[model samples]
Target: MVFDRLIHPFCICSFSLTVSRTKSESGVPEVPVPADDTPEVLNKALSGLSSRWKNWWVRGILTPAMISFFFIIIYLGPMVLMMIVLCIQIKCFHEIITIGYSVYHSYHLPWFRTLSWYFLLCVNYFFYGETVTDYFFTLVQREEPLRILSKYHRFISFALYLTGFCMFVLSLVKKHYRLQFYMFGWTHVTLLIVVTQSHLIIHNLFEGMIWFIVPISCVICNDIMAYMFGFFFGRTPLIKLSPKKTWEGFIGGFFATIVFGILLSYVMSGYRFFVCPVEFNNDSNSFTVDCKPSELFQLQDYGLPPVLQSITGWTIVKLYPFQIHSIALSAFASIMGPFGGFFASGFKRAFKIKDFANTIPGHGGIMDRFDCQYLMATFVNVYIASFIRGPNPSKVIQQLLALRPDQQLHIFNSLKAHLTEKGLLPLLEEAA
Candidate 1:
């Protein structure tokens, strides 16, 4: 009887505890619950939290750190900027060549690697030779060695390239001819994509740091704004090539990039260091940025549109001419620049890879960072050639000064006759 009484009380206590746990303070039935926390469940929750924290750190900290470092390099001037660009070109070429090699891993073609590098050297020789001849003509004239090289640069470049071609042909095995040809084509295409665009980037830099700075800044702004907007509000996907891209991000990035371009132009336009072209000053025996800036860097009054006038009660707005041009540049950056990245995305997807390389922590490789930049460079070069460039009197004068005394006098007499014929110059005083 005593044992039965204890059992009855224990059962009643257990029943009461279960009922109390199930009901809320107001006596409503609560949702069902698991009575025990399993180790697996706890571990999974912890793992998810850890992964989220890692992503957050990479996006917030590492990305900004890299951007800051790049800005510092930009501020160091064009020489440093050019070096950085060259380094990027090499790294991008490396990544692309590595991909091609991986795709044809079975091939053991002879001298393929050496020939690829030789082609790179030949292309650089051609492009940089052109740049030096064009921009530093006086310097080349002063140095006999460089003068000789400049005279035969094209022939030398062609000969070097031909040698590489011959090497490639000789190195091919009968069984691997098809693969060897495939790699040959691949190498040339990669050179066209990487080296040609890089040459244009150097051209843009020579135009002024503004051209280089503004366009690149716009792309960076677009990329950042797009990512931010997408993370918070993206729904509709923008393209199949890049699954994470969204329409919301695209629109957001576009608007942000326009504003960014305008602001960047305004700021850079005020600095002569950024507005003036890089030139070698014979007088100073060093590079100089002292020339009068182009009209694009000058301020112009633009009539405000009706919509903005209604809000601000202003009819005219004064801004740098390049600020106006920035609208087109930014539009292209937001709309078309992303396509460069999309193409890269497609390339990586085909290879079943996540990134070209993990050199930048969260940012992938140098090529990944510069994929959009190369496209922007090409556009900037084309835009300058079409709209901004004109006959440069300074370049003309520099070239004239580089000629021998006899040639100079001959040119002077020819110019005098032409000007006289055009009625711009008075004929010499009659008969001393």
Candidate 2:
């Protein structure tokens, strides 16, 4: 009887321990399991499946809707496009600064919010001033009001920035100084990331809509192609930061983007609307897209490979020079662009957040969509500076016009002497 009692209690204890472990492991409340025929159990299962299906349907509809809206905005023109970018910049700044505030919530720092916004305004003024002064020189020269602003643009920008700096310094509290400085650094870094990239994006847009559109489209194409390939064939993970990305997706997207870039270059190159730089015409009193397009937009014959020529009975293929440049753009979009997304993923993971914001139904946020685009923008700007952009004679003349009469005369004399040394002054005089 003693041994039987001992065995029974031991068995009971072991069973109780197993039940407790199961409950803990599953992380479910200790509720009684329903019978196999219970209506409640069947209803719960059906509800779960229905919820999942609804989510899938919502995502399907939202993706295309967002894409259509984007295309509509792009079709509107540069001014509309710029306004959208500015809105995005503000929203992204809010999201990032909000995160910083949340992380440093315990400090309860004063004036942090105001200071952040003030800095944003300062940076925008500085960058936009440079843009207007550079691209819209003629307008600045024509308008007396803008002439004053244009002359002291940098000084005005610096003074405004200094005012923000003084405000920040004056607002620092004794105990919260560390927190305030941390937030200050946060604001500046966010500005560098968001504002600087956006400035580059505007620069690309000013170069030509093609520079802006094609690079951005290549990024979008790569992203979609990558996702489709990953969803269908992904097995091996491409990176630990993003668990869903795969090597198959990356490689497939690369090839697809190259083809897409080539085709897009062909179409955009034919149109003066896409290839022409945005410029304000003094004669027309409005912006004009009419211009003789660069040679890159013009067609050139490229010799085909022997095997391809043999198969197609053609030795040469005609294509825009810009198409060759597109390969580089597409390649960067394929290779380095995804790293921008990866960096964002890692950033979100660091903060234990899914996305920067929930602005879009399925796409997380504007920042999420634009992470790669920002990187692509920087690349395009750098590419244009290194390979495409040249000194603008018109801008030079405008700068000379803005000078004092004596200064203008001195420049004119210097130019005439230089032309005479090159034996071009006689030709210029004869033509005149």
Candidate 3:
């Protein structure tokens, strides 16, 4: 009977009151109890939740594989990569337009979106776009490849963007608002994708992949340091823009990046890693191997001077591979990268959302993935432009400057010479 009474909810309440009264009557203060087995019940519930969180990453192999696939599309260099990003940009643009309109209350017109490529292209020229011919000559000295690639990219990207816009418009006509919004979001997406891809192509064309590697390495180091520290030592909030961020984590992570920069500069550059590596030589002929200079670079033969020795190892063996080449240069990207991330975070928060699409499971959406990268690319591009002008631009200025001296006389003589040699100038004179 006691056991049955203890099991009943109402009976338990009654029994608790009787116990409290008995204790009070006996001159003892009543001890408070929350309910029957409250602590144990809460503990069990918490345990179950913890288990789920601990094992959350035990997904199938496709999860990691899908992640790798996406990574390749972004970093695998031009050719196919340009196309992949074009598609992504179109998708992102649609998302942006939709999110702007319904959620963030941003205004955008249908016609503007439909003609966004042409619109932006015109604006691009005004902002800084130039003759693709001149732009390439400025970078590579020879503009042939650059010129061909430029025309090719312009035609393809514009066509694809226009096609996407038409699709969006058609979806609206068919009453498919779901896809209509998607197509709209795609335009913004395409902007980021195309911009990043183009920057990479240009980077490879100018200083080769080496110039671009700095941004990639630095971003990787920064992100890794931030996440590792945040996961382990996060306490105080780092910024209002991002609630989950921590000051301790950010500081710790940044310090780690500094260390990585220094370490890479020394280790990867083939310079001193504590003590610089000594050179060894083996000449094919009679040699002064013992008299060889103590240096980092190896000689082709045992007798060759260390200074004249062939570089036998990685080229950047003397400086930190991760160090920023230009301090004032990287500052823009450094500042912009975090700002971009904060903006994206703010966007997601505004919509009362957690993650974006869960494409990476742990990482969030494609926008989340690209937030920092997009800003970084833009910043770097601007930095390069500020420092380096194209050959065509340089040559054009040179040509115009040279014309100021004896300009008409030089042209008249050149025309006379051409007519004397080719006879075209005389034929034109006879016709006139």
Candidate 4:
């Protein structure tokens, strides 16, 4: 409350200017109508079809093109993929915040737009700073300014956020107090959803492109397969929020995704490029995907269960352990992932809007397409941390390298003693 006094009379003009920059809105928010911008030939081709059939055709045509572009981005390498992710994150934040502005337009709250963008900048700074420090340690340590920034990154982020928080409190007007706080909460929630999840996605990417590609591909596969099955075979509705979803489609999509995930994992697991964790190469001054393949990526003989062995007359099966893990990823993608979309649908219904924005013709917006993806990203990141990932030796070695020479020598001697007691030092020396 004390901070409210900081909005002196001198600041009113500039704050008013910022508020005026927000798009004009009527008292009532209008539901967005998705634009029909398909090619004329496509429209002509689909002219005879029913609306449902037309939608299916449009999505079918565009989906492959989107997938092709996705693969092109992948081929462009991780940096481009990361930049694209940031772009999407920014677009998604803009779309959600714009919707909030539309809904709260009657109050004409001050500093809403300016503070929203300011908070976006603050969160991006925090997350990207953490990422650079974690993944590019060598580069950060080489530069004095970067090392200091990395060292005090969290404090800087918190201080920057406090500045924005104080500004919001100061800009609040009496009549619009409630509405101002509502938009403030709305902005923070949007940042949590879009920026935070996309950052996890980048983390998964650094683990290995396989970790990134497989989970995303499973989600995409389930979405498309579910739609296809529901179009033809769906009978009983699955949920109230999503009218078109059906039990048949849900069941069909689950099986299809599991199979697709297994096959994809099997193919990807064999390639070092897909399985190796991304690392910064101090020598080449670049990122590298070169490393020894982990046991998870290697094929091994696994004995079948007694029932399966009896039925198939085989006792052993050769598979990548990653293929087994794929089932869990695909299961979540099929079974739990749709709930993210349902939540989004509920959010839209509450706001009396049809979609977040009409960025795509058949699809509603980037948010519409990615609602489940953000959820999936969070799950995959958790799964890797909880079950798949072990302590990274490279990270440990890097930390060791950063120590004082005496500290490094002490650690070396201690490790040598431990290894000698464990009887591994002799074996290691013999191999060397």
Highest lDDT scorer: 4
Candidate 3 structure quality by residue, lDDT tens digits, 153-262: 55655665566557556546333354345545554455545454444434432332333444544555566567667767788997897986787767776666666555
Error of 2 at 372 (Å): 0.7
Q: Write the per-residue lDDT of candidate 1 for residues 234-342, one digit (tens) a residue.
A: 9999999998899999999999999989888899898899989989888889887767877778888899999999999999999999898899999999999999999
lDDT tens string, model 4, 21-133? 33323223454444667778988999999998898988998999999999999888777878999999999998999888775565578889999999999999999998888
Positional deviation of 55 in candidate 1, in angstroms?
3.0
Candidate 3 worst ten-residue window by lDDT: 272-281
How far in Å is the alpha carbon of 283 misplaced in model 4? 1.1
Off by over 4 Å in 3: 1-88, 98-206, 262-336, 387-432
Query: All models: lDDT?
Result: 0.82, 0.83, 0.48, 0.88
Model 2: runs farther than 4 Å from truth? 1-59, 310-312, 402-404, 417-432
Order by lDDT, highest first: 4, 2, 1, 3
What's the number of clashes in each of the models? 0, 0, 28, 0
Tell me each candidate's TM-score.
Answer: 0.83, 0.85, 0.48, 0.88
> How well does candidate 1 match the true structure in TM-score terms?
0.83
Q: Could you report the Cα RMSD, in angstroms, for every candidate shown?
A: 17.7, 10.8, 19.2, 6.7
Q: Which model is ahead, 1 or 4, in terms of lDDT?
A: 4
In model 1, what lDDT does residue 124 have? 90
